[model samples]
Target: MTLLPDLVSRAAGRHAQRDAVVMGSRRLSYAALEQASNRLARSLIAHGVRRGDRVALWLPKSPEAVVALYGVMKAGAAYVPVDPGAPPARMAWIARNCEVAGLVTCADRIARVDEAFAGRPPMRALWVTDDAADAPRVAGLPTVTWPALAAESAERPAVPAVDADLAYVLYTSGSTGDPKGVMLSHRNALAFVEWAGDTFGVTSEDRLANHAPFHFDLSTFDLFAAARAGAALYPVPPRLFAFPAAVAKSWCEQRLTVWYATPSTLVLFLTRGGLASLDLSALRVLLFAGEVFPVKYLRELMRLAPHARFANLYGPTETNVCTWYDVKGIPADDAPLPIGVPCCNDEALVLDESLKPVPGGGAGELWVRGATVMQGYWGDPGRTALALQSIEVAPGISDRAYRTGDIVRRRADGDLEFLGRRDHQVKTRGYRVELGEIETTLHRHPAVDEAVVVAIPDEEITNRLKAVVVTRPGAAVSEADLRQHCAATLPRYMVPEAIEFRAALPRTSSGKVDRRALQELSS
Candidate 1:
């Protein structure tokens, strides 16, 4: 398939009456999904959203959100998924940065939308997915209710797009106190999706669980792979994420055949979700990524779900699932797992700082080159150039590769073992965060003079953030006060877990904040 929407069209032709998306009491058939998305695409075109434009989806995980994703693609525009739980200011910054042509949201978020736009909406039109009557009108913004959107023709709109065209833009935390957009094309996503579908043997009989949010790259596998195999997709409700018991109950009730999520989530289920008491015999394939899985927890999970085959997927958002390892068994001791060999027609190189290939059994930065690699950071050529470089694979030949900041070492068996990151970027709760971004936010507070954020290693969630602060003289700021300030401009995951007031921060020889010293103290 050249375009992403083709997956849905192909499935609709074969499985017209089959369930495509399922939530609580709601089921949308493949045929219905195709028709609904076609109508939504037509509506977007009528509202001046042209090809190559960007449309933002600002709602939570729901059936409508799924439809909106395909509709944006069908409209020949790239979709930008905004985190529903992000603060208004952060959401506004994303919308402004992407310069979205249209926005899809619900009525309950209208107030927050108003706060984000501040009476000056940037988009050309707004599409309300539910409860339109309760939505308040915003000045200078044309709102389209569901009834109006549904009235459009269900026939597919005539638009031209190619496999190399931009499909979606995912915003990730930037080291400069802003978010950076990663540009991914239809080809980039399909490279990984096709491989995953074939490797996992997904079929119409399989039921896949979409546990990650749409903004995350993991969701691409959940959505496209299911469509490719004509399988049923179950988007676990966002509300159930906080309650591990509810998530476990849903897993048993749904009888999910394929499950893909971060190790942090699985750890939560293993500890508090009551996994031992549940029956997961239907689970055939279980995949984990985003962070290293604690061997102790993984071993216990393997014992509980013996019927499922486990795999470790590793890569950054720029290169989706470059390398993976199938878990046959864990060692008796607490040894770090290998990320495995490259997949999806990708090439892996362990290169030193000078871009020379590292010798066997040596550690170096991981670099990936393949169709799965992203186009680059949207509208930021400098940062893009820094991450993506043209490496000389041979004496007279060079290939473009993305330099992953992660360090890995080649084992004797040819499997690559993952080490820590070379930079300050860390993953917590399956979300990538730049430590400098949190420190920048803290520095903005009037009560903080000097601040440094450190990542404390934890087996459960990968890492927990702790902020060491040297407050300004005469300023009486509490931890709660600083946390509340961060909540206004950053996501919850970016907020520091612990805050300590110090008289002065330790400094290194170069007069830089001593992060290592702070981390030792926090740990």
Candidate 2:
């Protein structure tokens, strides 16, 4: 009953005549969306996708992307939505790592898809939703166009799935140079969906503005919560993401009742997006996550959108939004906004190194326990075991808990206030970035001998990555050359904002690269 497709099926039946998805000039009714997905589901089944098989989606945010999502789930396959903007090398790694059964994308992206799958194990099929006329051919792989894929009957497939079955596998940056898939089950997604639907009082009348990319965990709430409440999902187009003013205009034109994005996105709108001039009388709930919102920009947003209720959500991809804070009012510019309390069916615990609860509300690592915690990292049991530890909650009573590497302190009001990270992982514009991954990419360039990536927090760039590189003796390379090398392998956000060349890296007594000393150099 708690399966992911169940949510879609129920919403389509209940709101059959209502708008289910709105993208630019296109609007899809629930019945139409359901039937289209059913056809796609049948297509996936005919193409040999089975229960638990990974179906990768490397498409942009559109009605077709939404259809592919539900269709793959309806076929009892776990959907893996890769950022369409991902580098070919990264995409290839994910495709091989997951052994994806099929990929749903457009004709325009076929060349990149071919490049990603060039030397890897073959993916079964490629389903192009837009066109197939100019689509590049990949050896031994059949290309199915939209019209041909829809030739299959629109009858629902009887794929066996349950609450425990995986709904999606989202790959995040790994410290070990590659990406790791965080396996989330239907039950895991439902925990946040149900909680968010109730918490925000969402209904069919409300329209949701989805700003986060499909691959991001934040988009989970935007997609599922809307379906849970039988509401309409309005996606922010990829190009509009860059032009903050256009984003503000779209928000007003769409009359979005609920808006959710990273704090940086919100800041962009307030500072330069013409948000002050917009007629946003329809906006209600405004939610932010992925990175800490500076109190200054937050206050300005509050002042402008005084009618909207603001909230802050906190969690890692391993746990989908365990805690949330509904802003009561604007606090002082210097005050820290707490991550707040646990969501429904979830518990947040502050623990020390020994796994015991932290004493006297002191700073400690945050551990999440409950339904929202992920099943585990896909195909990496050793790392999974390290992250998911068993903690005795009540003497003999124990539960599986995710050790979030965030340092936080429980406040006098019983809310958890985030202090900082315990590791090199930092959030850049709401995207979780592993500094080690950037360092690994820098090492790929033939010029450098040693590299260390550090986060330099700023008011404008948020948490930008700064790379300190030591080139091999007599191997000359400019900062631009190194940047181009990183750009070829990494996503735009993961690329270092600034690079510093040095004769040699600072070291500690143990003869290891001293990141702390390097931090001082950056400051």
Candidate 3:
């Protein structure tokens, strides 16, 4: 279990003929997946991808995304998955920042991406996916269609020389900015998959449903962990999430034995009237991560599927997943339970300003240590050093610990309760944000002279962050217009709650926008 390729090999040997992935009519067994990845690995190497090189994958959530991911790792190159649906500018930013050597994308999406990174980060080659009788989008830089490359490459791949190198860099939406690439090493990803499989008791008989996007780290649990168990990974289309009741019944019909999704996804199931009639009798395990699971929803879920085991997982994209809380049932008080503690070889502790562990029930910053931590931001050493630090919190253990920047308190029972982020950063709808990023985006608005965005704790949705701005000398600025501007540039979530106009924004002696004063004025 030292690497991801080992997991694929072991599972193939154990369950060579079992259905590993089921997407509509598309079926791939463990043996087929391993063999395809091996061929793809060879194909990658034949095209000049060496060990530790960055291979970018910009594709839809199909068998190709899954195979290409394993293939990049098998070729000993770090895979960087850019959401095929992401705005071209963001994708370009990620490619340039990560310095990707090659790009694997569909013919349809080739032009935009090519145009984005054109004249910027010099990409060596483009591997275009040929779905049918499709042409090779040959209008760009050195291009080789996927079918041709695979046909020319040897089916058996040469073992690459790599150990503890990066597996993939997952770029997640920033609450305030574009997106940050969470640099995950092979060890970091493998740690999470191994722990998730063991903790959830995944077996060959288990059928897990994958609803999250391929770009999100949560999808790792569904695809890799389930594949490792020789279990069927049922790919749920984005459309099904929109109509959750139909989807839930479909899962029950498929006899899905395991399920994992963000809290919002499952809440949609209940809200859309799907859970009441569905026989989730086949579902034995249920895991919700990403955002906070409402206690009422958890209780309802337990009531609907009494025999199913429930687990709440928590972690940022930088760290795959460090902590989990097992829900036997809801607490009588109905407050969302603590995220529990670290899993497997991972460790967690609350530290004060000086990095000393706080006493039980004392509040402090949550710092995580072990194999689960990421390598840090790709290519940005300043941000990396600020996040990943070395602190001796426990006896005889001193490694580069990642300060989660999340304020937490150790309960008398020894579990840590998440008390929100230490800064203006917030997690709304399962996406992380930095207030400064939103403010920066807002400042770009033509009329916006000064902007300060803050996360206002909301009762309805965990917290709705609102932005307040000062118009430039009687400039005609409407909240609606600014919101529309955000929609065009930023993702929908990153859009401000409101854009309030003020005579003059509160400023510090140094002439910086004082967020504290803005909060006071708004209150």
TM-scores of the candidates are 0.98, 0.98, 0.91
Q: For residues 464-506, could you state the per-residue lDDT of candidate 3 as single tens digits?
A: 7788888898699799999877765565677887778778778
What are the C-alpha RMSDs, in order, of all predicted structures?
1.1, 1.3, 2.8
Off by over 4 Å in 3: 119-121, 132-140, 173-178, 456-461, 474-481, 497-500, 506-523
Instruction: Name the top TM-score candidate.
Output: 1
Off by over 4 Å in 1: none
The residue pairs found clashing in candidate 1 are none
Instruction: Please give the clash total of every predicted structure, in order.
Output: 0, 0, 2
Poorest stretch of ten by lDDT in candidate 3: 131-140
Model 2 spans > 4 angstroms off: 119-121
lDDT digits (tens) for residues 188-239 of candidate 1? 9999999999999999999999999999999999999999989999998888
Q: By the TM-score metric, which is better: model 1 or model 3?
A: 1
lDDT of 2 at 144: 85
